[model samples]
Target: MNKLQIKYIRQMLGLSQQELGHLIGVHNSLISKIETGTANLQPKTEQAIITLFSEKGISDNDATVINALLEKRKAV
Candidate 1:
């Protein structure tokens, strides 16, 4: 997923960057960097976000869109 999507999802889940990072086993700065476009997410990290949101009962449409976006980025 892209930076905005990441931030949006976190917000939707009522999580701060630090909290999301902690849940995903990363430092908060990493989350910040990702959000600011200073860094890119690894595939594993993206998958972790997806899995976490899925567990939190995010809509299937949102998940599908995220996966599609990730795939499009991979193709670029």
Candidate 2:
């Protein structure tokens, strides 16, 4: 995922970088780096996030859906 997507998802989940890192077994700074575009999101971490969300019944699709709705509003 891109930096924007990561940040957006974190905010949508009401999680701080440290909290997400702790849950996913990474250092918080790594999450900061990923969110700032200083580092790429490693595949394992992405999978971990996906797994965590699945276990929590959180769908990433919600972000896309919200963005689409917002775009439609902008068009009016």
Candidate 3:
């Protein structure tokens, strides 16, 4: 996921960065860094996020729709 998508999904799920980090077994600072685009999402981290989405019943199509909305919002 891109930074914007990550941020959007977290917000949609009403999760703070710390909460997501805890769920994904990562440091909160890493989550911050990711959202800020200063760090890359590691393979394991991405997988964890995907797993989390699966558990939450958030499909890739949902993510795609969010991405499109975000891009459209940016255009606005």
Clash counts per candidate, in order, are: 0, 0, 0
Clashes of 2: 0
lDDT, each prediction: 0.84, 0.79, 0.90
lDDT of 1 by residue, 1-76 (tens): 6787788778878999999999989999999999999998899998888788888887669866866776787799
CA RMSD, predictions in order: 5.0, 3.3, 0.9
Better of 1 and 3 by TM-score: 3
Query: Which of the numbered candidates is closest to the native, going by highest TM-score?
Result: 3
Q: Write the per-residue lDDT of candidate 3 for residues 1-76, one digit (tens) a residue.
A: 7889989899889889999999999999999999999999998998898789768777999988889999999999
TM-score for candidate 3, residues paired by index: 0.93
For candidate 1, the 10 contiguous residues with the lowest summed lDDT are: 63-72
Residue-level lDDT tens digits of model 2 in 31-63? 999989898898999888777765666676865
Task: Give the poorly placed runs of model 1, Cα more than 4 Å off.
Answer: 63-76
RMSD of 3: 0.9
* Candidate 3 Cα errors over 4 Å, as ranges: none
Pitting candidate 2 against candidate 3, the one with the higher TM-score is 3
